[model samples]
Target: MKDSEADSRSHKPCVPFGRIAVLGAGSWGTALASILARNGHDVRLWARRPALAEAINKTGMNGDYLADVPLPESLTATASIAEALADVDAVLMVTPSSTLRAMCEAIKPHLPDAAPIALACKGVERGTGYLLSEVVTDALPGHPVGCVSGPTFAREAALDHPTAATVAFPFSYEDRLNPEKSPAARLAMSLSGGGFRPYVSDDLVGVEVGGAVKNVIAIACGMMSGAGFAENTRAALITRGIDEMKLLAQALGGKRETVTGLSGAGDLTLTCSSTTSRNMSLGFQLGQGTARAACFEGRPVVVEGEVNSVSVTELAARVGVSMPICETVNAVLHDGADLRAAFTALWARPIEAEPYALELSLAHPSPNLPLQFGDT
Candidate 1:
C-alpha cells in the first residue's frame, strides 16, 4: 500500500487490458488473479488439475494453497490450456521453476504471436543454469517478456498487504493502456492496484538473480537462527550474501547496481529476515536437528533455494565469480557439510578492508527510470 502509482511509476498514460490469462493456480497466481480481477480486469486462472479449477470456480478460493483467503468473484479458472489462452491479451506465468519449461511449451501453441508475458517464477534452470527469461525466450521467441519480483508472499498479497515489485519494459505509467502499448506497460497496468505496486526496470537478469540468491541466503539465516546463533551472525550472512549476488549479476553482464535495487536488496531483506520463508523453514528444521528427509517428507512445497543453491554455485563457478555464501549454502544442502563448518570456513577467508567496493555505475543506482529490458 505504500507504493502509490505516483510513488513508483513515473507519470505515464496507461489503459487496462481486457482479458488476462494467469497460468498456474497456486497461491501466488490466485492472489495476483484476484488483485487484477478486483481492479475490473477479466482474468482467467489456468490450473493443471481440473478438480482444483472446479473447486476455485465453485468456492472462490484455492483449496490447496490458500484455504482461507477469498478470491475475487469474477476470477475464473480452467483446466484447458487453450481455452485459458484464447483471446487473452496477456499471460502471467506463475508456475514453479521445475515446471516452467513444460508450462511454457504447453502454452506456446496456444499463445498469440507477439503476445506479452510476465513471469512470476524465480531461480535458474536446474541443469541449464539459464535465467527464467532465457528459458521463456527460447520457448516463446519474439513474445515480449518481463517479470515481477520483490518481497511478496502469497498469503500477504491475498491479505491485501502492501507489496511492491521490480518489473522490466519500455512502457511507463505515462503510456495510456492503448492497444499499441508495450507488453511491459500492459502487464504492469493489469497487475497494479490493491496495495500491489510495480517499479519498472530493464534489468530482468538482476531481478532474477536477486530472487534466486536470496532464497539460498534465507536458508543460511534460518540455520543460524535455529542453531541459536546471535543476530550478528545472521547480519553477516545477509551482508555477504548481497555482495556475492552482486558479483554474480555483474559477471552475467547485468548492471552492477541492480543488486541493490528492489529485486536484490529489497527481496533479500524480506526473505532472509522472515522465519516463515519456505527455504528458511527448511533450514531451521535442519538446524534444529531434523534430517533432510524428515524436513521435506510428504511436503509438496517447492523450496527455490534448495535447487538455486546448486544452480547459482555452478553459475558462479563457470564465470569464476567467487560466491562464498552461495557455495556454502549449496554445500550444506547437498554435500552434507556441517553448518557451523561452512560458517567457520566463510569466516576464515582473508578479510578485506572494503569487500563491496567496486566500480559501480552512478548513472542509475535503481530501476526507477523507463529503461527497457534486454536493451543493454
Candidate 2:
C-alpha cells in the first residue's frame, strides 16, 4: 500500500460512541479527552474553573494544563457538570485519589444508565486503604467499571506517544479467556483503539496493586537519585521494589508475573526516572535538603506518594508484610528519620527469600486486597 493509503487506513475512525464526558480538567484528563476526540468520538470536558473552560472554548487551547498544544475544535469545555454528562457514552473519572469518592458521589446522579466508567487516576485511599476502584464501586453500584493504567506519563500519552495500558475486571471463569466464547472479553477487546491499546486481564488485583504500590516505589527511587546514587543502586531499588509489589499483589490473589509486566516494572521505571513525575520530583528536592514549601515550588497540587506511603505502610503491617523500603520512605518523609540511616537500614536487614515474613499473612482472606475492579 502507498504511504498515504496506510496513513488513511490507520486514521480510519473506530465505531463511534455518541458522546464521552471527562470529569477532570487536569493535564491527564485533558490529554485523554483530546485522544478520544482524535479517535472521532464527541467529547466534553468539565472543569471546575470557569476561566479554564472559557480559555479552552474561546482560544481552542489549554495552555496551562496541556501547554503549547492546540485542542480539537470539536472538543467542548463546560463549567457545568450536567452539560458535560448529557448523553455521554462513557464517563472518564480523573480526579485525585484523595477526592475520588466525593467526586463520584457528586457525578453519580447525572450518570447515564449502563455507561462505562473509566478510571484514569492511581492511588490507594488514605484512611480506608481501598484502591481507587473500590471507591468507584461503592459510589456507583452496577456500573460497568473499567480502568486505564500503565506506564503512561500524561505529557507523553497526550502527545500521542506510543503507550499501552490494560483494561481489566474480575475473572469469574477460565472460559472467558477464549475471545470467541466470552462477550465480556469481546467487549473489552472492542474498546481498545486510537493511541491507547488495552490488554485484557483477569488479575484486577495485580493491576491495581501494581499501579498503587509503584508510585510509592517511585518515590524511593527518586530519593536514591537525588542523593547522587549511581545507576546500579537505582536498579537495585527498583528490583527490590518489585519484590515487595509481588508479595502484596499475590497476597490479594494477583498473579506473580503481573508485577513483572508493563503496569508494574514498566511504570516503576518511568515514574522513578522522569522529572515529570510528581512523586519523584518531590523526592529529589527532599534529598537535596530543600524545605517542603520550596520543594513544592508553590504548586497547589498534591504529590500522592508522599501521603500514600504512610497509609500503605500501615496496611502492610496488618498483613505482616515487611516493607522495609516503603517503611523507610515513610520515616524520612514524616518521621524525620535520617535519609542515610533509612537507606542503610534496608541494606543491613537480614537476608531471606522474596516475600519473606509476608507470605504467611496471605494464608487467610484479607480485606486489604481489592476484590474486583469494573469490566473493561
Candidate 3:
C-alpha cells in the first residue's frame, strides 16, 4: 500500500464533539453523515423529500440511495432545512452543484453565524461557471468555507472501508503551518476516524478544481472504455487528462502540486477506472451507442460529468486554456456531436511537445530571433 494510503488507514481518534448538519441526503451525503455519526458526532442528514427523510428517521436506512447500508441509530434525518441547521457546530453541503446556490440561500436564515461550511459536492456552477466554493462564499459571506474531496465512493466509505480525502481551506501561510488552529482543521477532525482520514490543505482552489475537473475526465475515459478501447488507451487518456486538469487548475490560481495530489490525480484515477462512478457509467452507456436521453430515462441520481463537461469546458475557454478531452465530452454530451467522430478528431490533432515542456518554453523564450541568427 502507498504510504499515504497507509497513513490514512491508521487509527486516529481526534474527533471533536459537536453537532454536524449534512445537507442533501443523497448517496454521498448519507455516507458522509454516517461517517460523522460513527465518529461520535451528533449528525443530522437533510433530505429534500419529506418521505425520504421520514423513512430514514424511522428505519435508519436511506432506501433510495443506500438501500443496503444500514445507517447508525444515532444519526437522524430531517426534511426541514431549519431543523437540520439549528444549533449545528458545522455544516456540510453535499447537494448537487447545479442547485448549490439555492441550497445555500435556503440555509441562510438558519445557519449558525460561526459554524464552518464544507462542500462535498464536485462541479463548476453551470450558468455562472463559478466554483462550488465560490457559490457558497457568495451566499454565506464571512463564514469559514472549505471543501472535502478525493477518490471516495459513497458505499465503500459508508461500510467503513478505508478512505482518505483532502480537506482544503484558503489558509494564510501561518494558518497552513498551524492547521490545527483553523476552522478547516476542526472540520477535518470531524471527518476523521473510523477508517476515514482527511489531510488538511490550504489550496482551496486546487482542491475544488481537481474535484470538479476529474468528473469530466472520467467521462472521457469511460467513453474510451465503452468504445472497446484497451488499457493502453485508457492510460493515455488518464495521463493527458491530468495535464488538462493541471493546466486548468494552475490557470485558476491553484498550485500544480495540488492537482497532482489526492483531489486531482487520485480522484481521476479512481473515477476513470470504476464503472460505479455515475459519470463513468453515463459515458460508458453513451459510448455503447445508447441515446443520451435513454441513458437517463430511469436514473434518478445526478450525473455530475454530464453537467460539468459544459461548464468545465466553458471555463477553460474563458481562461484561454486548451482542454480538448473536456471539450470533446461536452460536444458529444450536449452539442449533438457524434461520439466516434469526436474521438477520432481528438486523436487526429497535430502532435505538439508535452504540456510541461511547452509551458517551460513559453516561460523562458529564446533571446535570439530566427532571422537574427541567420543574419549572424
- lDDT of each candidate versus the true structure: 0.81, 0.76, 0.87
Query: What TM-score does model 1 achieve against the real structure?
Result: 0.88
lDDT of 2 by residue, 59-168 (tens): 98887888877777888999899899988877788888888888988888888887777787877787777777787888898776656677888777777778777766
**lDDT for predicted candidate 1 compared with the true structure:** 0.81
* TM-score of each prediction: 0.88, 0.85, 0.90
> Is candidate 1 or 2 superior in TM-score?
1
Lowest summed lDDT across 10 adjacent residues in model 1 is found at: 367-376
Q: What is the C-alpha RMSD of each candidate to the true structure, in Å?
A: 9.3, 9.0, 8.0
| Pairwise lDDT winner, candidates 1 and 3 | 3
Deviation in Å, model 1, residue 340 alpha carbon: 2.2
Per candidate, the number of residue pairs that clash is 12, 1, 0
Worst 10 residues of 3 by lDDT: 366-375
Candidate 3 backbone collisions, by pair: none
Candidate 1 lDDT, tens digit per residue, 117-224? 888878888778898888999888988787878888888988788898877643445533443366665677777887888776767778888888999999988877
Residue 1, candidate 2: how far off, in angstroms?
A: 26
Error of 1 at 313 (Å): 0.8
